[model samples]
Each structure stands twice: as structure tokens, then as C-alpha cells.
Target: HGEDDHGVHDGDGPIASDPSWCDVFAAAAKNVIAEVFAHAKTPVETRRQLQKNKMRREAARQTRRTKVVRQTTVTATRDVQLQNHDDHRVTKTVSGGASPFVSAASAMQ
Candidate 1:
């Protein structure tokens, strides 16, 4: 820890190409690389845990899908609102151009 965190050295020590030095250098490189990749798994595991926590939090608020939903102010409104169970599509006009896959509403008629 006394030395610089980066690999760069100010030449306070001898710069040598000796085989033993190379061996030590290779081992240190391997250790640092392994440690970096080891920490890499932690973030991924944390994300998975966070997603599971969100799912559990949602489990408490969930009720029957057939129940009426009146909290439009809290949640975003589905493009199409269904009373019972039917899923409908409500087309919205984007002030911009449409996706290349779909034709414009004016063109369709």
C-alpha cells in the first residue's frame, strides 16, 4: 500500500528483465486480474437480489386483476383500459414519425 496504486513506478528500484522478476510480475498481474473479476460477480448478484426484493414488495400490493383500478393518478394508464379481462389496443399519436414497421393512420385509411 505504500507504493503507488497504479503499476507505474518512479524508478526508485532497479529496472530489471530478470526471469524471477518476470515471474513475480506475472503472479501479481494474475492476482489483480482475479480480484477484479471476483468483484464483478458481486454487482450482478446484488442486482438479482434487488430485483427479487422488488418482486416481493409487489406481492403485497397485488390483488385480483378483475378488481377495479381507480388510481390513475398513481400509476400510468394503459393505452387501452379493460373493464373485465379483455386486452385492447389504444393507438396514441406521437407528434413524430411512426416506426418503419407500422404505416401511418392517415395512410392506412
Candidate 2:
């Protein structure tokens, strides 16, 4: 058994909150943490597995974010293209309305 490390706050005393402690009653503490502090004994394999799981979760999160960003970008560009086409078509119609063909048709009314 060693001192506690959960508290990093230093007091007026000589570093009473040293995190370098590991205590292993059922197992060996030195195999977990080298610091002279109190910590639970964890298996190396278990720790590695937890790290890998975290990495996988992070990768999945990044992939989802990328997909959403890509979809949104594509949709926005498509909308812009549609709007541009609409603007051009409306301009052509408006310009043609002032021509003699449209005026002659209106004069027939």
C-alpha cells in the first residue's frame, strides 16, 4: 500500500497528496502503476482492450461526422445549382416577354 493520488491539490504540508501509490490486495500493485501512490490493480490486457475500444468508438464518431458534412455540402451545392438555373430561366422568360411576339399576342385581346 502507498499514499493516495486522487487528490492533486497540494496542501501546506509536504505534498501529502502524492498520486504515486498502488495497492493490490488480491494482486500485485507494481504491475499496474509505478508511482508510489494508491490505485486499484488493473490487468494490463484489460487496459489495452479498453484503450482499443475507445479508439474504435472515436473512429466511428469521426466517420459519422464526415458523412454528415459531406452530405450537407453536396445538398447545398445542388440547391445552389438549381437556384442558378431557375434564375437564368426566369431571366430569359422576362426578356422574351418584352419582344414583338408577346406584344402582338397581347394586342389581340
| RMSD to native, candidate 2 | 15.0
Candidate 1 lDDT over 1-109, as tens digits, reads 4555455356434545467888999999999999777657678777688779889878756753324365653354453344222311213323344544334534665
After superposition, which runs of candidate 2 have C-alpha atoms over 4 Å from their true positions?
A: 1-39, 98-109
Q: Cα lDDT of model 2 overall?
A: 0.66
Q: Work out the TM-score per prediction.
A: 0.26, 0.52
Best by TM-score: 2
Q: What is the Cα-based lDDT of residue 78 in candidate 2?
A: 100
| Pairs with steric clashes in candidate 2 | 5-19, 20-35, 20-36, 20-37, 21-36, 21-37, 21-38, 22-37
Lowest summed lDDT across 10 adjacent residues in model 2 is found at: 17-26
| Full-model lDDT, candidate 1 | 0.58
